[model samples]
Target: MAGKLNEKVLLTGRQVFWQDTLQRLFAKEGWDFYVLTKDFPAPEEVFRIHNVPVVLYVLDSQAEPKSWAPELNEILAMCREHGVRRFYLLESLEMPEARLELSEKIASAWRGGEMTVSFLRLPEVYGPGAAPEDGLAADWLEASQRGESRTGFMETEEKREFLYADDGAYAIFRTIARDFAGESLDIVTGQPVSAKELARTIGEVTGKPLSLSVSEASFGGRLPDSSLVRAEIGWSPRYSLKDGLAMAYEALQDEGESWQRSARRDRRINQLRGWKEKLVPYAENLAGALLMVIVAYFQGGTTVNPAVYFDLNFAYIGAMGILYGKGQSLIAMVFSSVILLGVLLRAGANAVALMYMPEHLLHFVAYLFVAVVTGYFADARAFERQSNEWHAEQARERYDFLRSLYDECVVVKDRLYRQIVNSDDSIGRLYRIIRSLDSVATENLFTQAAGVTTQVMGVEDIAVYVLSKDGYYLRQKVRKGRLAFQQPRSLRVEEHDYLKNLIAEKNVYVNRELVKDTPDLAAPILYQGEAIGVVELFGLDFNKWSLYHQNLFSITMRLISASMGRAYQYEAEAQDKRYYSGTRILREEAFREILQELMERRRLQGEMPLGILKVSREGRSCEELDSICGKVTRNEDFLGEHQGGIYILLPDADEKVCNMVMERLAREGVTAVREEKML
Candidate 1:
């Protein structure tokens, strides 16, 4: 009966490859699926698609929230109008808050109504080529593999939840088929496993004894609980963690060859295109030259004029004519007239001066004709050379531009890959940045700005700060290093003097001694619109500033400022709902209490604050308090996982802490120690 239901599902947005896979998975489950490639489609066109009764919006978290909201509403309206009863909102695990809000909005639209709308939250899905450094699951797996037994606040004993790609697809299909009354379903494995356990399972599957050295600090956030999902859908995952790991590993092995083959194909295509472009002009010029030579031969009366040299003169004129074709008509005509005039003058002069000597007169005429012919050939050859040179110059310029673009792309790709591999919020931020920047014409302008500013300011660190409701935050569109800051709290832009000036004046600011003088400037810096936090260019040669460098810096500053403004607007609009929720969340003492407990746990495990803290000698004793220190290190675990905090790993237990803990540790004779934590 379920297989017979003539229902069609529509999936939309970027990452077409993933969407295509999902479509295939759906077909395997007996339902027809249609994918929409555009970011947003017209409501009428969407309605016109044949056989698609249900719309499954697999929206990218980084997509423009405002744009998607209206599109979603319109689709829902169309679904309602067409008597389509079901709508499902599927979200990935990166930005839970945004997903939660989207779910709530969808629920509100359908709740107590005839149509059925529900939200499904998927766990980190893994497949072949799955490494902790590539996908969300891979990020967690990588962390567990790297930090097995190290004591740090970021280190967690709690297990993570992961769903295989197929398992996740199956779960979604099952949820869509099931008749449920709820507004949300967690499409995940209901089992909870610790990081250590997951690592062991991966090691077992790979046959590699991955010795994990866990720092007491827990760097990554905890997985969301999916108990609610299991209860509502009456669905359970078929694959266990071990089974999923094995399948993922096998898939990666099979896909390795395919990935290599695709890369080689891409290289070959590029090479072929380059060769085609090089040969096109040469072919055109050669054909044009041959035609001109034939025409000149016929114009010379097809006679062997040894005395008059008419053939030579005609050849010169014809060659010159073709050469000048690429130029202005006026220029070609002027050169042609000059050649004809010179030939006629020489012919007439010899004909009159030595008329009695027929051989000498004939020789003069022949010489004039030969000179004309040679001149035309020389002109044609010169024009061809110039055309080729110009073509090569243009190609060189284009190649340079493309090379620079490729470098920028590589930088962005690497940054995105790192974020994906780490499963960090920066991934979400970067995705948003890319989406927002996609709408702009000057895509590479931001990167250029960062490079120029770094050189001009003579500062290793530069960051662009945009004014937000809660102060200023560094835009993470083009980050250079690991992101340690949260959206609002981690990257406080109000502290930096240069940033403050930039924001206030809406202009560029240059500070040479930023590090020593500006104590509040953040690292992995943002310059102009790019996130080039800190650049290490040592041994500065103070050469006289050239106009080129100056112009580059000036242009970069403008571009950065413009990009930052656009990014700021996009983020501001996207975060409005979150900003309100954040205010409420922050005001909730329960949330804070939970956060405090987690921070204490992190401290005990030795996880320091997100940013680097230069602990002064005056505060050195604060490291020695074991009881208070333990609470601090362990606080991270209690803080709901996502809240960033400090950790303290005691090296030999002699580290100082708060006044109370310092006195107690001193009395206990715990003098020297070592400790570590996850940031």
Candidate 2:
């Protein structure tokens, strides 16, 4: 709002109350904020045009909350594609008609380890600029001071939670200050007070007693459980309903009436959509200028002053502003100059007509004028494009430059790369060697060696273990034959003796039993101060396999190891997550594992056909569907979300029973595409 954030925070909300409050709070906190009233990040230009590191969406969908559901998916996809590392979405948990069990189920479905997408359901809001419907606490305070009772929104004995404006700001600060792993936190004070209790507390704080009024009998339970939120973020609001009501009373004593009087503007559609609206008129102008001129030319006007027919080129000049730097107006002006000159030099001109040719020179001058006007504005756009490219090139060069701390290893890499393609001036054969090694997968490392490579080298087997992403472990990715390893998956650097740090060269070990008359070659493959894998060779007759083959083997190792290292590095960064930023729904692998275990358990107990039902949300509320399943299904029924659907695996249950469950779920509130599969 004022200063800059540490990085840009994309705030997607149109409300003046909360957005304005957050802007004031985070302005001086070294965070730059950019608001997107519309959350679609299409054309990439909507988001890629900015350096947004994080997206914070404040969803105020109290009215037609379901309508915004589809937009959220689109916004999230765009955010993910643009490499937005994290998202923090805040909305209220309480829905007007949502039952306690149903709403909790929906919220739980939205929970999980997709750490990038977090939805924080804040407590009932009240502050300086609270909306009319949202000003419960503020309204209560005002009524208490005037000894009047306001009761339409309040139900007798109904419980609700409250957070002050300052506390809401504080909660927002803490939410963004730390990293959350796709967990929904309820920013509540953990205390739920009834309407009468709320009014009494405010009355005591305001020093004015309120006359109690309960016109009807109604029951409202306590607020939703937010203990999970408090535990996950390790944050607790300092304001209780009593304390917050007192703060709201004094600070918002006279402000409530004013805030309620303030008119609420309708949410704005993305104003950026207006940018392309110019294309329509620009296309029309081009067609209007060209189409009419072509018709005029065909109607035979070359001998006369074509200036009248070509006057539409001025319209083209105006259109140039829409497509600045495209040179459309310049091209038209140049072509018009040709036609105007042709008209002036016509031989059919008589004495009076010849005098008209000099005066008609003003038409040519007009062409030059249009060109200058269009070209001036067009050059501004061209300069901006060139300036952007220049800055980007400089940034790339600066970023790639290292300060001699770790770049010294690049020298070794360069030397090895040169050796692959530069072998004693016979570059063609060396180039072939590099290509063959690159194409050879680790699975075929030995098969290729036994082919044309066997004539040059006799290596029995090859195993590969690339460095893990954390840089502390090595994973055995691929191997041709039976590998000598005790670890099931991977080994840490300090776990294996041969896999220890071998930075300079391959540390070879002599094995006598590899051959009766020959020795085995075994060594830790080293690259960049870490042991990638231990390569071992058996039955290599040094007498037949000369030094040429030994050198070839070294070159092959260099190419293969570097490729493996690069691949492992990419995989670790892209796929490895400390925690997933999605709901606690099972992944495909986890679902399969659970299915197998359940099937096995059922088989041991007895024999039965396992019923597997896959339900696709199909543009419906996934959270609502999840709730229906939880409520209607049995405890033993396995329900997990996979591939954009809820998979319900019920052991010993047939299709008939599955249909019954589906019917019950539909009654509860899930409408989805269902398919039954037997396992």
Candidate 3:
């Protein structure tokens, strides 16, 4: 059953490797693409939301049919119920009869409905992004890069065709773009390569020995015929075998380099430990021996009986034993005994005669006893400390590894969320942009204008300026993206009369006249044929400088203008209720609603910078507080009164800007602290 297709595409599968590449291609071709993963809560809800005319069900041959078949059938039936009449079942030719079983199942599931199912049987797909277990080529490449021999890993004498990931994605993209359906097509390269040939080619590309043994006489099932796909969809592989292998090899090299860097860091740490263990104790022993000799020299002949003075010698020996282990302590004991004998000689006592003295003998025995006892305990303590350190190191390493994994998971989840929710070319993005400006508060509208302009126009360097009260200047209220360098904070209308007049006439100004410091595109945020503000696009890709993008910029500015006009009208009708009687500061209730709206916008926009500063009254009257703060705040800044405090909302502001605002308030004798939890 052939039917007209919509601009939406729903891609669902067990493991879809080409989803990202295909998403980019679809976005470029003006299609709203959505992915329904196995973990998604409700398939029926997605089907209803997208209302796509086509569904792409990719079948992973490696997965057991029993695991995915029932779910696939249920989804197919749901798609039929949701007005999806076209389906393309992307499968691999390596699977034997699995394609037939799946196709038959889909047919049975949609028996009473007008369903058109097409099968695109692909060859072995491999590229840089392919997982190691994806195919034989990827597996072999992984083993070779890991310095592993694949000599007998899988002794198959078969020649199989392989398709690069991008090429396969392009084939499917063309099929969908051309609306080709209801037919089985084999998508592959014309020539098939044997395992030996593939192994050698990968070896050459990666500069590593594959060490694989492939049988000379290769045999395999019939290769897929790609001529039909080529003729119908005008698709062909853009990468040759060598070129594809090279790309994969380069990617593997990048990963290998990172691993090598980590390995080298570990080696350096181990070397430092080796030096500490082997050399540090001997250095300590030498320094301790020298200190003992110095003490012996200073104690010269102070005691009439040198043997009695030798009591201090016992203390030195015991201290050395406790500090160093048994071996080094014994060496230090020998040095101390020598120094004591020299001191005795200097005091006119014979060494042999002193040995015969009972006190002297007792003192010598005490020295040996102290050294042995203290050294043994010291050794035990050292061993215990080392064991504790080892356990702590292990625990620390485990904690660090777990933290790294958590951080990686967070990054991957954020990336996927961005792709699905905030993709640049989806209709949902446009809808979100429009909805962000739907607030009737003019302050809220101005707060959201910069972000919405950047997101919709796909430009990084943008500046928003509002027309000053007397129309003397367009003062810069908000700047988004990379305008970090110094730019003028104010633009005098007389300096740029051309731009001012054009914007007054409700026309967008492109930088075709070569005005210095002028943005690439500037449009008026018009309210009743008068310019209230201007949105300037300072930078964008060259491809966006054409008539189409200029027209788009013009239209986006008009949308913002209309929203601002409506907000102004609403403000006039309920000014006193929304704000305090004399100031631009909002009341408590209106402030709460605005906070909720801004937070929702932040969440949807991937956590755009939103800073809230809380200014406490500190026993001052509301009138006095407002009078002081109003002079320091910008027109774009949102000031709200709540609970005897003033909360200021600064949109698209980071720490630097927040600090500047705090400083200004400090100069005015007002205390303010950033409310981090409010965001």
Candidate 4:
């Protein structure tokens, strides 16, 4: 019967007679069940573990001593939801005329479809572990033990049926085996016993006089007929009332003896626990004080100076502060001061009055001051430790936000570094051209530009020139390959459509005729909108090129133009670089005029406002900063050195722009602070 079963049952109560009887009868059988007690898991978890198809809910109904327990409706509701049929055990179906609150709800739910329940009514069951307060058999036994002559309760001649615990348990097993669903049956012994006759029978068993005194208020009901229950279960009681009473009295005698031994053990344990609680605290403090004195004795002890122990005393104060807080630290400090004074008096004082030895008086005052200050700080330290827990929670929320920003910056830096290193990109082409002009020693500007352009552009030839220093005629610096020029020897700024377009529109022509049959790439090399030189590539097939690649290469020419301008200016002048005159940045006098021009234009045109930035470097290297300024500032803006600092005039920039410039300068070994101002 117990080998393997697809279905299981839940027996939800801890009553000794009913559950123990069922557990022993169903042992090694297919009717597997679980008994829920106080230590069992929560009700929802119990449903998940057992998954029983049937529930025998005994706690909320007749098993509990109260008329109705809270779990009665709750356990029934859970069984109904899981489609588990409920088998309810009871003492009787006949309710008193007045019903309790829980009983009223039980009647309502039974009428509705919320509860599917069957009843199995039992009689007054007597067995081991039955309380002396419940049932007439135990009550009579308690009177005989106390040497009372009689017990007062119940009508003297009122008769009630009796059933042994084992007989009632076997009847329940037979009823389940018969599969009696939703049937109510009174499973009793059908043997009546009078209340007075049960008291005399208990006296005979216990060898003590016992009798019953009739009370006016009593339960005089008779047990219901059990003819149908006997037929349905095919079972009958195995024990008569006289035999059951004799066995029950023997069990009560054994239980009274066992309680005497357990009470003695509990009393001894309580006595030991009471002593430990009163003495353990005093023992710990005494141990700590003794250890402090031992440490002081081992240190250097000079002659007749009690304050030699001051340093060691302070160490104890700090340790006590962190352990038990400020109040205990002050107490430790006071105790040590008293100990020091007592030792000094016992040794022999150097002087008794402050007038004789003023140094000794100052040491005593210093000792008191140290204790007061240390105690104040210890209190603050404890408060800070408590407050720091709240601040740590706030900082935890911002940690994730800061980490995301740091991760985003790392990805951007890697992408930018890769673009500058690849050879096929525009930034790569510009890097190569700058390296070529920076490394060469040729004085002529176009000679170096032609060599680098040929390598980077893969062109047949390149020719370069710039306007003469007086700004009148074009002066040819160098030429390579056979690039014919159709312009006059001294080209005027107003002559030729290509030169007019280069001056007016700042255009770079590619794969189009410049003079006549020269259809390649040619650009106007302008430095900050002034013509510096020219670079032309020959034999380029424009029909085979993407518009994007041509435009990207056109952008590379502008970057090359700025580098060529610096090379042209350096070639023309060989004088020493002054602070402002020969350097790339402007002088103060030039900056003043540019500022005036920008302010007037902003007032008239209603354009975006301008910002002035003052950058301080604190006299670190200005050479690195000058080069960065030449690259960072627009041609329309002004950069000047003033008072060991740099000034930048941003015409269409705001405070945010000033901060961006400060960040870029910081990367070039310059620590700059920008104070932005609006015009």
Instruction: Give lDDT: candidate 1, residue 180.
Output: 56
TM-score each candidate. Answer: 0.37, 0.35, 0.46, 0.38
Error of 2 at 176 (Å): 2.6
For each candidate, what is the lDDT? 0.49, 0.57, 0.77, 0.59
Global local distance difference test of model 3: 0.77
List pairs with backbone clashes in candidate 4.
1-29, 1-30, 2-29, 2-30
Judging by lDDT, tell me the better candidate of 2 and 3: 3
**Residue 458 lDDT (model 2):** 38
Q: Please estimate how well model 2 matches the true structure, expressed as its whole-model Cα lDDT.
A: 0.57
Q: Which digits, one per residue and each the tens of the lDDT, describe model 2 over residues 612-634?
A: 77765656554555566777665
lDDT of 1: 0.49
Candidate numbers sorted by lDDT from highest down: 3, 4, 2, 1
Candidate 1: tens digits of C-alpha lDDT, residues 1-679: 1345656777654352245457777887777787765423344455543536666776556565775677667667767655566777776655457655864576466544456777766656676545554454454444444444322234566555677776777667767777554666667576766656666676787676555554564434336566666676666778887887777666655676687899999999999999887665455445544544454455552223456655343443344444443332223333333343444454464534455776645644654454455556656788789999999999999999999999878866865564464331234533433343332222233343334454343433333332333444543322222122122223455676665554555433334564543422222224344443321222223441334434434544444555655655654565433222332111233334333433443333233332211111223232333233344332211111123322222211223443333344345553322223332
Q: Candidate 1 versus the native: TM-score?
A: 0.37
Better of 1 and 4 by TM-score: 4
Q: What does the lDDT read for residue 566 in candidate 1?
A: 61
Cα lDDT, model 1, residue 169: 70
When superposed on Cα atoms, how far off is each prediction in RMSD? 29.8, 30.4, 23.5, 37.1
Instruction: Give Cα distance to truth, residue 273, candidate 1, Å.
Output: 13
